[model samples]
Structures are given as C-alpha cells and as structure tokens.
Target: MTHNLQNDLLVRAAFSRPTERPPVWMMRQAGRFMKEYWDIKNRYSFLEMCKTPEIAADVTMLPVDLLGIDAAILFSDILVTAEAMGGQLSFEQGVGPQFANPVRSRSDAEALQTDVVHKLQYVAEAIKVVKHRLQGSIPLIGFAGAPFTVLSYLVEGGSSKDFKRTKLLLHNEPELAHLILQKIADVTVDYLNMQISAGVDALQLFDSWALALAWDDYEAFAHRYNAYIFSKIDRGGVPVISFCKGSSVFAPLMATAKPDVVSVDWNADLRHVKDGLPEGIAVQGNLDPFVLYADKKVIKAKILQLFERMRGTDGFIFNLGHGIMPDIPFDNVRYAIDIVKEFRY
Candidate 1:
C-alpha cells in the first residue's frame, strides 16, 4: 500500500519544512497500543521477540499502519544495548530492565566492544526488514540508550527512582567512571552507526533517566559523553535527535552536540525551551503524556495551545512529552494526532 519511497513525513516534519502538516510521532511510537504487537508478544518473551528480526520488524511497522505516525522507531528495548555490552540483561514485569553484571571499574569498562553491529545482527536485520516492508511510506528511526543512561542500567541493574548506584559510581569513582562512559559512548556510536547502515532514516538517543541528576552531575557524567558520540560521524550527516527525558536543566544545552534536533519531556515549558534554544536545530516534544487522559474538548484546547507555542518555528516536530502510558484510550492518541494534522501551522 505504501508507494513513493523518497517523500516521507518524518524527514520533512523533523525540519518543519513548509510543505506539509507538522510531523507527529510519539516517543515510544511502536509500543503496546497495537493488538498485533500484543498478539506477537504473547507468543514470545519480550527478549525473544526483540531477537527475532521478523517479529521486531512487524512490530516496528505497527504504528505506521495503525496510528499513521510520520516515522517508525525500531521495536527493541533500550536496555538491549547493555545486554550487547558485557552486562547481562532481563526485563521483569512492573520492575523494568535489569542487568546482572554492572560496570564498576576501569576493568569493567574495558570489557565492552564497538562491534555491536557484528554482535547484534538481529537488530540490523530487523531494520532492513522493516525498511523493505515500509515501501517508503515513512522513515524508520533507530535508537539506543545514551551512554550515561544505559550505563545507569549497568550501575543500578534495573529501575531506580533515584539512580543511587549510578550516582555513587560517578561520585566515588569519578576517573574510572569516565572510562566506563567513554567505552559506552564508543559502543553506542557503533551501535547507532550500524542502525544507520541498516537504512534507518533518523536516530534518537534516549537518556530517559537523566532528570534524576542535578546540573553538575549531569554535566560531569552525561552531557559531555553524549556530545562525544554525536561529534564523531564522518561529516556528521545523520539526522540525530537527543532526548534526555528528565534533565530539563540540560535539555537546551543538548543541542550543543549538533544533533539535528533535541526532544524535551513534559516537565519543561515549551515557550521557555523554544526561546532558550537558538535556531537551525529542530525541536520535538515536551507535551505531557497524561494530558491524553482529558476528554475531547480539553485535548483539543491544549493541542491548539501547543501549536500556538510552536507557531512560526520552522523545525518543530510535535510529540508527547514522554510516552503514551498503558491503556491510553485509542481515541486520545488519534485525537492528539488529528489536532497535530489539523493545525494550520
């Protein structure tokens, strides 16, 4: 059903080029909402599904077929990178991602490799399969956890509200920690490069837990390392968007890495963010995911409100501040997208 290969919404919406309605893709756009995903997932454990290129590719295209989003994100867990590294990984119900062997010293850092493309062939294959099936309908985005964030999983081993173990690793073992970050950054760049090579049209580095740190800690442990990865591309040609979900303090500064854009979570004010950032770089998101809980009128009003803030901004990509939560009524997601498509801006 998908026809032309060259023209796609994400490529244009990401830059807010004037030819179309603003582009819209949710953060976890290829997630739980679809029955097909659930049906496939019901047949296998999450990790198994991820390792199966056929399954992963099918799920990646679910949002494209169901929600009509502008782009498709490869369907895989962010923590998969940790598993690809020297660490062991598993996902527990309600508990989130867990790692068995966390990086603690320089020795631990030395254990990782930048050859994840070779190591994680399934992920690459998944992208290839998804791209072929997409028939040029939309761009596919490939992503991994940012070094600091994936390392947070390595240090903490799983979901942590405070990220205490990660901070301790940074605070108590600063120099060794830098080595770990450097290693993770190296591998992340490789992993993302693999995705790009596999035909990903764009990439997003998700550091969803960054909000847990204060500015100084974020600067020391996070911002610089991420910059290092984004800086190294041959001509730095790929369109990369960095989204540090919690670090509202450093969200604006994230653009310094020269990513094509930066995505903000719901915590920050779009007006303040839009003004704080200089032009040329595109901006995506910062809308509260829970706002979808509101009924039609409120959703419409707030959606328009967001459009107003983004008015005149040439490269804004509309997205949720975070991901759509579990059991989010189908209508809410559709209404939000309709608002985005209907907006004159």
Candidate 2:
C-alpha cells in the first residue's frame, strides 16, 4: 500500500508542476488496436471483462507494457454506472451498447438508484487489483461519463447523431432533466470517490456529448452538473480533469468548473486552447487520432508541431485529441509514443 511511484510524470504534469518532459498517455490506450487486447477480448464479453477484477486489471496494464505509456486507466465503461443505477445495459456485436429500459419519463428517471458505492463496487475492486499489479510504477486514472453524456444514452437509448430525444426532454421537461442530472451527479461523485479510495492517482470526467449543445445549453446542463461533481468529490489532492470532446469553444467555461486539467479535442488548436484557459489550469491534447494513419515522417512532424506549440508550458500532457482509432497501426502508435518521449521542450 506504500505508493512510491517510479514514474509520477503524469501526476506532476497534471498539477502544472515543472517536469523534464511532457508525460504521454492516450485515452483508449487499451483497446482493439492491439492484438494482445483482442486475445483477451476473444475469451470474455466486454461486460465480463469489466466486472472481473483480474481481467480488468490486466487490460488496464496493456498499454503500459506494450506501448510504454505513463499511465494506466482502469478498463471500465462509463455506462456501467448507468446500468448499476438500474438501466439494464448490454452490448451487441456491431450495434454497440444497448439499454433494455431507457429513461424517457419521470417515472423511468425516478427508478435510478442514487447510492452507487455498493452497486459499482466492482470498479473499485478492479482499481485495487490494478494498483497492486502496477506497484505504483505509474498513475492509474479512473473516470466516468459527465451527467449530460450519460443522460444522452439514457434518453436516446444509444449513440445519437442529433441527440433529439435527449434535447427534447431537456427542453420540454426541464424539471425532469434537472432531476435526472441531479441524481446522476450524486452517483458520479460517490462512484468516483470510491475509485479514488481504491487508490487511483487521478480522475477524468468525460463529457463526450458536450459538443452537441450550444454554449448556453451546455452551461445550463453539462457545466452545471460538472461543476457540482467537482464540488462534491473527495479528491484528496489528486488532479481532476474535465474533458469535453470537440468543445474547445468552452475552454474558459470549462476552467470555471475548476478541474486541474482540461482536455482538448482534435478539432481545436493545442496552443490556442491552452492560451484561452486561465493561467493555473493545465491542458491535455489536440492531436487528431487519425494522424497515426500517416507515415512516420508525417507523424513525427505532427508530434513536433504540437510540442512546439506547447513548448514553454509547464503542464502539457502529450496525447491524441481523442481515443486511438481501432484501425491505427500498432507500430505507428509505438513510433508516436517514442516521438513524444524523445522530444525535448
């Protein structure tokens, strides 16, 4: 239980502490892009892998061993919390995640349990397994979906293009939307704290659907709850990252939420977004995930460009703007990581 971290670069950079180099870790570092991951996936269903502590721990360590990254994020789905809150979740081969009972009404929303510690204890168990295996070599990141993103799934039933169902509910039943968001915020705080208690070094709140809303609507819904979660969580001095995919326009607003770091999506300029945020907050990414598909020369150039943009900054963590694409060549990812590790800024 004595965590003498061999490499605390990620943790230090997250806190805006000066470091020799920027730490690097991808979002979906442990996913289908690696043959080793598929080797495990072939043996267990996704849900099974998540629920089983040993399997989840192994998956969490994959990127660190295979790709030489600075962090190991726990291998668990954001929706597991939703399922634990009584949404009945399942996965399909190509269709992605499906919910047996989507929350579309006040009655449906009322059914979600607020006490998440007991229901989602598997995640905390998995975190302990990861920490023991990791031996404090590098940080372990734990995360959950921001309330609005989780609400998108609950209202739309799955992935959405327009989020029409969710938007309609937010507009037509404002009180209902608030009720659901409040419940989710409460659960998110407890669930995240449970992960921290089990020994995660940092946490990230992923609002993948934040881009769907205009700034005004985002403030009304996503920002409000994100701030609430930040306010309530017991962080114990660990850094909390607020990440809103494709919403660089809200960097200043995201800063207002007061997370230690704000992750930028690929569509934004890394330098521009960082400059926009307040002085104390650190910035995470902006490299397009598809940049890996290009040749080494291009990848190196792209990596160098990002480094140069963030050259003088204290808290830069090199990463793809989003998760690594499944088709991205494994060798290319390795080369990219090396480029990042080798660069001197």
lDDT of 2 by residue, 199-266 (tens): 99999999988999988889999999999999999887689988888557888899999999999998
Q: Which pairs of residues clash in candidate 1, taking residues 3 or more apart in a chain or in different chains?
A: 211-246, 211-247, 287-321
The lDDT per prediction is 0.78, 0.90
Top TM-score model: 2
Which parts of model 1 have CA positions greater than 4 angstroms off? 1-7, 234-237
lDDT of candidate 1 vs native? 0.78
Least lDDT summed over 10 consecutive residues: which range in candidate 1? 1-10
Q: In candidate 2, which residue pairs get closer than 3 Å at backbone N, Cα or C atoms, i.e. clash?
A: none
How many pairs of residues collide in model 1? 3
TM-score of 2: 0.98
